[model samples]
Target: MTQTGSYLYAIAAPVGDDVLGGLRGVADEPVRAVRHRDLVAVVGTVDIGPDGPFGEEALAQNLSDAGWLAAVARAHHAVIDGVARAVPAAPLRLATIVADDDGVRDRLERWQDGLRRTLDEIAGHAEWSVKVHAPQPADPDTDPQPAAGAPGAGAAYLLRRKAVATARDDALARASAVAGQVHEELARHATDARRLAVQDQRLTGADTPMSLNGAYLVPVAGADAFVATVEELRERYPDCRFELAGPWPAYSFVTVEEP
Candidate 1:
């Protein structure tokens, strides 16, 4: 007989039968809830083996597999979206599956209060990402130059290089300052904020410089105003690039409680 594994989707408030209906997980498996006290663990079925944890060397290997990772991510997002429509929810990290429904029940019993607080805090709010980039310094060869052997040619070249370096440094410093200002201003309008990894220029496909990459949790009511504030800041700092996206699930803000 083939052994089975429990695929954990998300933890949410106890949802009604109607609310839980019509949702699917990996392989189009119908989603089900494992209830423990006031908490519910949305789950689906997977295959586990007697070798312990599945047909893999270790838990890490199983978790890192690309196809497995993608399935879990999709399942997690799907359940999170469904639960969020009905009630506030705290989405677990991708591939947070355990051996069976019992493990989920244990977790729910263990972390009930913290989960409640997290859900309450995030209710009716969503996350947003903002990234800023600045233009790269102009190349030296592109600059107008005097003919070779002109008076003070060597000295002028050194002086010009020094000036260019100074200007680049100054621009970088200004961009940093502006990024701080933007973060601070946005924080005032958001329930929570975080600084994320700065994206590399090559990845961004722009000669523009990246000054900031940040996430913010904003109430639904405040989203329009928050966007307007960002637009105003963009106008104020015409030299830098300001990009914004989302209204996504609060992935960055959820905290896992110790069991």
Candidate 2:
């Protein structure tokens, strides 16, 4: 016999049947709420056996398939985004699965207290991401001009390398100081702020190295102020660049861990 399950996306205040009826989740499964009192778990139907996309075996196989992973991730985000509009919600980590409706109920029951508290904390707020990058110094080897009346080849090459190293270190120190000030300025407009480890240049497709990657939880009403503050930072640090993205659902603030 084949077993079936539900993939849970988020938990929130009671979502009406009408609200759930209009949406679909992963695999185009209709979105629905499995309610236990005032708390509701948003779920989508899934097959749990080896043949299914979300199955234990299938998950491992698909992890490296970028296209498949992107599609599933987008689907998961869609449900959470829609739910957030109707009610304050706490989004679960991607690919959270339960054995059945009963399992969904049990998980919700265990998390009921935390869910309520999380909802209250996130009420009327959203998340924003701010990233700052420090420009890379020009490669000394690119020019490689021997200093006036200096020795040829070997000595000149060593001198150029040392100069490049010194410039790179100086740029990094300046960027670090600028990043700290930028974070402090942005935090003034946010209810909560976090400094995340900087992402690699390869991942960010950044021309320069990332110096600061921060997420902020800002009140919905104050979103404009938060963005304006980020803009101000850009002007303050013209050498370093900034990327501000959001009014995203409060993903950074939802701290619930699955039991």
Candidate 3:
């Protein structure tokens, strides 16, 4: 028989039983709450046998499988996202597992203060994602007609190449400057901002190069205005492509132990 472990999804302020009703977590197990003092931990039972997906040895192997990882991640996020909709919850890192309910309570007791602070910090805020991509500048047109076989022709060709390279660099610098301005303007409308590494074109499958990958923490009351600002920036900078996604749980703003 497979041994079971508790998969912790999130720590939240006290929540009603209905909040967990109809929710299925990793392994399709029903999610339940374990309360300790003023906090509740949302968890579900998962197998921890040597061959089971959540087992220490098996988990490392399973993470290498993209399809399996995606399905499990969706289930984990689904549970926390559902709870966040009705209460202030701090999501645990993906794959947080313990021996059993007693272990979960012990964690709650140990981390209650930090968890409470995190929940308070994100109580009425949501994370917003914004990406700005700019088309790569075209290479400078070169007139390579330097009279082949003529004196100094080789030197002229080298000069043209250098000029072309310089022009491209300058154009990229200008585009980078514009991206900075956009981020600064958008930051004005948010409570907090985080700049993420820009994704590669191959991964994004975008024809243009990304200039900015940013996440913002915005109050619910200001969500509409924040979205409007994004649209306005999009129009103001016609050269850049803008992507906005929002009203999500504050995943980027919280810090939790992954191990």
Taken over the whole model, the C-alpha lDDT of each candidate is 0.79, 0.86, 0.87
Clashes of each: 1, 0, 0
For model 1, residues 58-138, the per-residue Cα lDDT tens digits are 556867877877775676687778777787777777656687888878888888888888878888898899888864554
Indicate the worst ten consecutive residues by lDDT in candidate 2.
135-144
Cα lDDT tens digits for candidate 2, 20-133: 787788778998889998898999988778888778999888867999889888988899988887889899888889889899898879987888889998989998999989
Best prediction by TM-score: 2
Model 1: pairs clashing at backbone N, Cα or C within 3 Å: 134-209
Q: Mark the regions of model 3 whose C-alpha exceeds 4 Å error after superposition.
A: 142-164, 256-259
Model 2 residue pairs with clashes: none
lDDT of 3 by residue, 161-225 (tens): 88777876765676687789988998899888988999998999987678899999898999999
Q: After superposition, how far is residue 123 of candidate 3 from its true place, in Å?
A: 0.8
lDDT score at residue 211, model 1, on the 0-100 scale: 85
Superposition error at 209 for model 1 (Å):
3.7
Q: Is candidate 2 or candidate 3 better by TM-score?
A: 2
- The number of residue pairs in model 3 that clash at the backbone is 0
